[model samples]
Target: MFTHVDAIAGQLGRGLLLTLAMTALAFTGAVAVGLVVAVLRICPVAPLRAFGAGYVTVFRNIPLLVLLVLFVFGLPDLGLLYPLFATVSTAMALYWAAFVCEVVRSGVRAVPRGQAEAARALGLGFGQCLRHVILPQAVRPMVQPLGSIFIGCALSTSLAAAVGVAELTGQAEFLTLRYDQPLTSFALTTVVYVALTLTSGLVAGRVERKVAVVR
Candidate 1:
């Protein structure tokens, strides 16, 4: 067991790097899509609002794994071939975007109505009000929830293994199969996941406290 430590460490390092890459890609894409959808959902235009609502409803209802499979296996026949990691990242991002949209919309709605009215009275246009006044206030309260979303994304990287993405869980499974060390491999994976979750929680807690203080 001691002799295998170096090999295990190397495998874990690779897995961690892959997991981080996936998480960063997913979070960036999700944030972009979610912010746009959230703004559209609150827009005065009926069609845009309806479209945003429909998008959220549809994607939020689908299972992430199903979406992953569709992207990885189904898209090739349609000439939309994606690398395994890219496919997994795209699916996860799209799936997570629906939830992020709802979270951000709720944050936007939580902004006091008076703030928007005051901004308008001060000659701020809709975009200015949102960019300068409304969103700044809304985002503070949303930090904790957004942190949880980040943690969730980190955990969801495990699903990438199903699509042959070679993320943390994927590497762990491969190592276990190769070395016939299921117990050791799984134990290490569990520990790594726990550390990741705990780190997320700590960061979130600090942000939550800071927001409370600022408020």
Candidate 2:
């Protein structure tokens, strides 16, 4: 059993790397889109607000696997195409973006109304106030939620295996079948995931402490 573990370690490491890479890229994209949508959700313009609300409603409600299928299997016939990993990453970003948007919006809303009022009183436009005042304060509260989103996004990368991206879970599946060692293969995979999530939690905790509101 131990020898089998050693033999498969390299393959599992590569899969882990792929999972990490996809999660990092997808989470970055998710944050960017989420931030934009969140701004739209709060902006004064009604149409932009409606578009933001609709986007959150649509993506937040869709199952990630369904989104994956639509991107991987449903898009090519319409002449839109992407590499397997790229397709999966896009789906993950779009799906996770909804959650990220809500987290950010909530953080923004948590700021005292006086802050925005004061900024506006000084003749600062919405964008200027948000960029310099609202967002900096909002970010301290956002660290943990954003970190949770990152961990969730990391787990979601496993779904890429369904479309043949050969990420962590996919490699575990391959090893399980190849060696008839489901217990060993999956135990290893589970440990890796636990480690990843725990690390995320620890980092979030540290950041939260560092940015703790003095009041």
Best by lDDT: 2
Best model per TM-score: 2
lDDT of 1 by residue, 1-215 (tens): 67878987898889989998999999889988989999999888899999999999988998888888888889898999767888888888888898899889889888889999999999998789999988888877788788889888889989888878777898899888878989889888889988988998898888777765243
lDDT per prediction? Answer: 0.87, 0.92
Candidate 2 at 204: error in angstroms?
0.7
Candidate 2 lDDT over 1-215, as tens digits, reads 66766669988999999999999989999999999999999999999999999999999999999999889999898898778888899889988999999999999998999999999999999999999889988988899999989999999899899989998999999998898989988899999999999999999999988986765
Give lDDT: candidate 1, residue 36: 92
Clashing pairs in 1: none
- Per-candidate clashes come to 0, 0
Cα misplacement distance, residue 75 of candidate 2 (Å): 1.6
Question: Each prediction's TM-score against the native?
Answer: 0.93, 0.96
